[model samples]
Target: MWGKSTAAVFLGMPLSVLVVGFAALLSHDQASTTLPWLLLFFLVWIAVMTCTFLFRTGLRAWLWMGGLTIAGYAALHFLKASGLVRIAA
Candidate 1:
């Protein structure tokens, strides 16, 4: 019961958002290429990451970071699949 507690789910959410947003913003630039959605996403993610930190739970933090890594991989897969990104394959 403790391992899958509401706290872990809640705590992981923010960190995931923050990390995803960071990836989005870092992936693109140029005023015209800039997207409001991306910016919003970034801010939301930062907020989430902040909240996770506030929880100060070591297990939650570790899980959050793990989820973040998975999310990053998923994003990369999407980008590659869409042909928006190339990995020299």
Candidate 2:
């Protein structure tokens, strides 16, 4: 539980950001949409944390979360390079 809790606290935050980023990118990416994601971020973070505990072990949680974050960043870069979305970063 300690490992899982740590993973959830540490990894889950970035995963939630990536998820929100993905949503924002796929959406209209305007000021009007900002509030919705701001509201939804905590929900997504909580969901990711909850889902982490469903993994078989702490290592799995960390591995999967890390892998997912990497994949998410890759996808973000791909989208940016592909010129599909205009990312400030």
* Strongest candidate by TM-score: 2
Per-residue accuracy of model 2 over 1-89 as CA lDDT, tens digit each: 88799999999999999998888767765566766987899999999999999998899999999999999999899988999888443
Model 1 poorest ten-residue lDDT run? 25-34
Clashes of each: 3, 0
Clashes of 2: 0
Q: Where is model 2 more than 4 Å wrong at Cα?
A: 87-89
Model 1, 1-89: lDDT tens digits are: 34434444554565555455545445545333336545566466556555555545657665766666678768766876887764321
Per-model C-alpha RMSD: 7.7, 2.1
lDDT of residue 14 for candidate 1: 52
lDDT for 22 in candidate 2 is: 83
RMSD in Å for model 1: 7.7
Query: How much is 9 displaced in model 2, in angstroms?
Result: 1.0
- For all predicted structures, in order, the TM-scores are 0.38, 0.88
